[model samples]
Target: MRVGGSEYQFTGTQSHPYWFGWESMTTENPSVVLQWKSEGTGEQHQQNYPVILQVGGGLLHIWYISPGEVWNKVGTAPFSARAWHKVELGIFARPDTTGWFQVYVDGQLVADARNARTWDDRGNKPRWGVYDSKIATADQTHWINGLKLGTSRADVD
Candidate 1:
């Protein structure tokens, strides 16, 4: 069985911060996303723990409960979910298309850099965890939702 997704464009410039929840979908990476949808299409985990998704520079910005860490984390997918990974903001140098990118897990700042690139061979609404042949079939899935592009906290803060 399969499921279709949604099409929503945020109404704002680089001055609005978008946010979503872990109903069951997040971006593949946390370093380079700008929007989201609550569509968990892909693989199956031990169970769904839900996650926050984002994009920056060109990496997926994942904000969720790392499977095996002390503190939650925000990093690229294809990673484990059980460690308190440390993040360093200002990782980039000039802010991404969304103005600037920040990383936070379990309510903490990890990395915040600047870059002008995002995950878009198709546009702003990029797809993550899309059954990559590079990985494996059993590992095909994107696990987060609620996307926010063209905006961030700094813009409103």
Candidate 2:
């Protein structure tokens, strides 16, 4: 995967995360695995978007936009390069502070966030591939298998 170049492998609505189980097998790379991009105006005030899963610098980064037009890191874990890892993101979406998000690696709960303002008026949807990155020339090769999005955790398990 290249840092700047990308191809969205799958696209789905924000609600898909709630009733669905997300799973992917990937080798370590400093690139984005998935992105949930909200509507943006391309202007300075509206450049922010929603959730994204990125791995880089030996860390897995789960970032989501907050109310202040900023990207906030909600979850993170150490990366294991050259090995296949199963990653899962389970979302409990609520407009209020009651909403939560969870991250699992190899079926082990690594990060759980509560009272998070996960979405805004723009809404969210998934776009798999390389997302926007910090480096223009950073590139990587990753293998993915068993990528799934479905209505139950068992679907991915």
Candidate 3:
């Protein structure tokens, strides 16, 4: 899914709660599950995504990429394969130190980043699905369902 255009783009101090179910068949390293991408052009294209949620080495990780092209591993959570798992994510996208990101797995708070920078230039839009990495060694399959995005936890939970 691609969340761009005026209707879905977000920036500044905002609270977005997202809920989804994910099931992976391969323990592929750096299999990106979700991303918040900057919509800027030219030089900004070289900058990494504002945020990335991915599975690396059978574990879920949250990566925060700064405007200066720094990759920060903010948090990680346990991931179980071959079964659908509930994921709830909340992001406070801000360019300053007041920003934060939180992740809940199976109704438990697994990972969080507080007082961190979570925004980039020109705002961002979300994308979902399994991306990156080469899983050619085995037949790889990923299932994503019930994707919901809302202003509060109640709306998506």
Please report the candidate that would top lDDT against the real structure. 3
Q: What is the C-alpha lDDT of each candidate?
A: 0.33, 0.61, 0.68
lDDT tens digits, residue span 41-141, model 2: 55532324455678887777887666576777877877677767777776655445666667787777777777765554455555566655566665655
lDDT of 1 by residue, 47-96 (tens): 12223344333334554322232223445532333222222222111112
Off by over 4 Å in 3: 1-7, 13-30, 45-47, 136-139
Q: lDDT tens digits, residues 1-157, model 3?
A: 4455546546575555333333334344457878877777767654457688888676888887776778888778777666677777777777677877777877778768777666665666676767776765654556777777776666667
TM-score of each: 0.36, 0.69, 0.77
Once fitted onto the true fold, the runs of candidate 1 whose alpha carbons sit more than 4 angstroms away are: 1-6, 11-14, 21-98, 115-123, 126-128, 131-133, 137-142, 145-157
Predictions ranked by lDDT, top down?
3, 2, 1
TM-score of 3: 0.77
On the 0 to 100 scale, the lDDT of residue 152 in model 3 is 62
Model 2 segments beyond 4 Å from truth? 1-29, 40-47
Worst 10 residues of 3 by lDDT: 17-26
The 10 consecutive residues of candidate 2 with the worst lDDT sum are 7-16
TM-score of 1: 0.36
Rank by TM-score, highest first.
3, 2, 1
